[model samples]
Target: MATTSDPNQKTPLEIREIQELAIAISAKNINPTMLSQEFLKQTGIVPNEWELGKQPVLGPNLSQVTFQNGVSIVAQPRNITFMESIGTKNPSELNIPNIARQYVDKLSNAEYQGLSISPKSLIPFPGSENGARNYITRTLLSPGPWQDYGKAPVQAGLNLLYQLDRCQFSLSINEAKIQMPDQSSIPALLFAGNFNYNVGSNSPQEILEQLKKGIDDWSSDLKDFQEIVNQRFLAQQQESLFPGA
Candidate 1:
């Protein structure tokens, strides 16, 4: 399928039956550094100072921003699953019509709630960059609405699993016990806005940051992780290859 270059396209080709939830609120009293420190403390990892200078401070004027994400959960077709399994030594079969409908219904409800808010009326992030800096620092959506922090949309799938209530959609993850239910479910997070959400040009530092954030998930499958990194950097490489294209 040909991907649409039009930014205004209602739905992108890769996304199917996507349901989004957007929440805009004042980001006051939310220090991303403090949050990061807390997260590091909890994770038992030392916070690395990259000499990134000061992460931009959000003043009162631009403090109000949307905290939003979209989800696309669909039942894998038999043929698609088979195609996906072609080279595998052991391919597992799927139980169709299992929880697909239930998830879809939940996404529909999320979309309904998301649409109630008017993003246009709210103030946009000031400056050239359309995405908010604080959100990127905190990684509200791990694996990304921001890829600079080293999280892929796929890893974000795991992150979303934790956010969602199991009662609505049966899913769980336990690292200590090494337990993960619903292996078939693939999840991603997307940002919706009138303006672009890209954070300037890709830099080595940002890429390094992204690598650090994704290192844990990277170990299981380096090939898959490399693909995501390649996709993230492709646009920049293209722009450099054909400047002023």
Candidate 2:
């Protein structure tokens, strides 16, 4: 099946507009790295405040805004995204038309088709979870463990949204404890908001509590979305793949 809007159908600009709208709704407000620094500075875990996001060119999403003491440190995006089929549950029903699918596969494997990752096909069932793995590797969201649920919110969120093309809602929450790249672990919280780059108040304590409740709800919501996907997916393929049902 084709996966593209009719060439004569939606105008280039209109298509772009919808895409933007989707992204706008999808953007989350969670940034754990920034929050950590804020907490350290504001209440002063140490006499001297640490220079966390002062210059802010650092963490995951690479924040563009400058957070300050007077800024608000609300929940932000720090988790990976995953798709939650909003209306329809059957995934195959929502498949990209062959035309648009070309983009999916093209945008996906085009890079690897001739690169060091060319061997991507050798990886096996390039169409199953493997496809998601390879498409992400050379194409969209960063590739990692296929069907990985352990990546942070950002990665998971991207997977849910982009890979599955489902409308997703994300909530920033706190972590029990995360070890920093430096291996010097610290307790941290995640939220979406502007904060003081160096010195500000971040609700680590609150974030944890909030996540305890919020992530759970969101996770449940996603599960509901997936149930729909699985059901729908089977429905769509039954006639062709399962026939005589």
Candidate 3:
């Protein structure tokens, strides 16, 4: 299975998905600083000093800038579960997600409903191996080495779990040889993504066998999630292309 290098290929990969997936695979172990740093890195953030209550926070510039690698890194706001930003950020880091429940009622006609966000959408998932390898490396950078101002290890764990919960474990067009749905045949899609959405974490032989038994359900979910993501991203693209009153 040859991976397509064309960025304009029918099935576009998303960095957010990669970030979410990496978070999922390394749920048990993560270094909050490195976790935050890598996440911030993916967001293309350059560090800065931020005043937080009595102390100051070192933040990065979360702007939509392309790196040497031609990746678009930006910050997206979201309704935070139990987190808050350090307030002052560079001009680039200003576009934080609106992670508040109360703001939901005041949203305009086009805003995403339910929750607010304040996210840093940085690099595309560095790919499965790199993404996984990143987590493995970061977990070793524990907070015990640094005392009072140590990064929140538990926070990283929770964030990792959150990402994992939202991530799909299958590899991208590269490693796992997943075919893009709209680009390939149904048989190809099914054959490639046989047990992707189904089965527990096991050997390939086990997953392939499980697919024989549980393919119907797995296929349905795979299609469903794919469609939902495609439509949502499509809608987002349309909105980005043309703005309305």
Candidate 4:
């Protein structure tokens, strides 16, 4: 028997823009209070001329700093994360990876566990507020009688994990709303990718080398993510929204 495609079916969502990129390192005995602006300058982790975007948060267990260039550093007891808003800048221009490598090099005494490089983006669906929700419930998932049990429409999200040769990759898709500058909000899908690498060595030098290698391979991982999202998940589009991929 021949199966016919539904004519009323809507188009699958495509990635609209790259929203944020981040590098997070997990370690032991990390003192977040030590991440001061003066300490960052003294250690050469950040340029001396760079001004802070806001007042630095220095606490016993957590610390945070935002630079004027849209780079933000957040440190907790178990991990430290460096994030930057992609905006219109090319991903190649990002320096957070270099900064993270420098930090690990300088703080060689800390016991590093693993690191993850993540890229987050917004996938906008055309027409209607329920586009993303419908994509998840009706498209990605199998239809069953369970969907009719809910009073409101089903809200769903997906998380997939894949073990690659060099790293463990995970992609999460969720329904989200983005607020515009005019105070209006629109429905969208958020595609988040994480490439997690484990540093197996206890030696600081070995850990630093491992982390540097992960950072170096981040661009390729990002490209892989782009291919997966664009070719496999979303509409059949060959063009990439992310620059330098």
User: What are the models' TM-scores?
Assistant: 0.16, 0.21, 0.19, 0.86
In candidate 1 the C-alpha lDDT for residue 35 amounts to 26
Instruction: List residue ranges in candidate 2 displaced over 4 A.
Output: 1-210, 239-245
lDDT of each: 0.22, 0.25, 0.26, 0.77
Residue 215 lDDT in model 3? Answer: 21
Q: Write the per-residue lDDT of candidate 3 for residues 1-245, one digit (tens) a residue.
A: 22323223343332122111000111112222232323443434322232122322223322222222222232323211213222223323322221111212222221222211222111222233233223323432344533335564222211111122423433122112223445541101111111122233655455434323332232233444344334632233332222231
Sort order, lDDT high to low: 4, 3, 2, 1
lDDT of each residue in 85-202, candidate 1, tens digit only: 1111221221111122222222222121100110111111212132222223333344434455454322221221112121111121111111113222212222222111121143
lDDT of 2 by residue, 22-66 (tens): 001111334444534444344342124323334543355543322
lDDT of 3 at 230: 41
Candidate 3 lDDT score at position 47: 28
Best candidate (score: TM-score): 4
Tell me the lDDT of candidate 3: 0.26
Best by lDDT: 4
Residue 8 CA error for candidate 2 (Å)?
39
Model 1: ten consecutive residues of lowest lDDT = 77-86
Off by over 4 Å in 1: 1-130, 138-158, 163-245
